[model samples]
Target: MTGGTSDARDRLIEGTRQLLWDRGYVGTSPTAIWKAAGVGQGSMYHHFDGKPDLVLAAEERAASEMQDQVRRILSGEGPAYDRIAAYLLKERDALRGCPIGRLAADPEIAGDATLREPVRETFVVLHECLVAAIEEGKAGGEFRDDLDAAGISYALSAVIQGGYTLARAEGSVVPFDRAVQGALELLRLATHEGR
Candidate 1:
């Protein structure tokens, strides 16, 4: 019974996360969440106050998953530039927009600071992690000494977000690949100039 309860709660959060990502906050309903989770209305409400409560929990889970993925990608044995490039080009099934970025764009989410806090914090953590890696690379002479680690971190992140947007907008992965390729080319140019 205890195990079952935990399973149900996990299902509810996972379901909410998927639904919220596929369809923004406004489109996802408590009914849809309950259905997707294979839980009854009573079960969902017992675990969460409502959609907002559940949404916040879901966002946190998503953020944690992304952080874990980043750590794994960044910690691997390789040249820093290679690791960074690997992270950028890592294979994913499809362009299912960044969950946190999607939430950030929702007006309802943006209006509520409490709701937006996790999304903002997630990006901050990601940026800091990337910047630290870049700084390490600079120290090792792998990256340009004059590189602005902070700006580059944000720029790399922005390119990713923009790639998703372009892919979704143009209904193809071409734009996404082009965006990443362009960024990679710039890095190559900088490295050559640095040497």
Candidate 2:
């Protein structure tokens, strides 16, 4: 019974994550969530306070997963720049859009501090990871001394989050690919090839 209960809770969170990604918080109704989770209506209340509470769980799950992915690539075996490059070039469902980024545009999520905190936290982690990698690169002479780590980190972040919008707008990944490649090329220009 405990195992079944745990499974139901997990399923609800996973289903809610998918629905939230497909439909914004306002659009993802409790009916739809329970239906997607293959659980009875009471199951949601059994595991969560309500939609808001459940949405928080899903957002945290998605945020943690994205952060972990970024951390792994950023801390991986390679130069700091290479790690950043690997992150940029990492295969993703561009047309579907960024999992955490897409939520930023939702008014319902944005207005609610409790709901928006996970998204904010996710970006914070992403920014920190980029900043750390760039700072390391500068210290090791992999990047130019004239560059600003914080500035570059934010710009690179914009390239990704904005790239998702551009890709979704056109229903193609070319724009996204171009954006990442362009960002990588620009970063390369800031590198010390011979120095």
Q: Give Cα-based local distance difference scores for all models.
A: 0.84, 0.93
Q: lDDT tens string, model 1, 1-195?
A: 599998999999999999989998898898999899999999888888888999999988998888878878866676667777887898753378788888889898899998899888888877877887787788887888888989988898988889989988988888888888888777765563435
On a 0 to 100 scale, what is the lDDT of residue 45 in model 2? 100
**Residue-level lDDT tens digits of model 2 in 37-150:** 999999999999999999999999999999999999997777998999999999999988888998999999999999999999999999999999998898998999888999
Q: Could you report the Cα RMSD, in angstroms, for every candidate shown?
A: 1.6, 1.2
Measured on C-alpha atoms, candidate 1 has an lDDT of: 0.84
lDDT of 1 at 49: 88
Under the 3 Å rule for N, CA and C atoms, how many clashes does model 1 have?
0
Q: How much is the lDDT of residue 58 in candidate 2?
A: 98
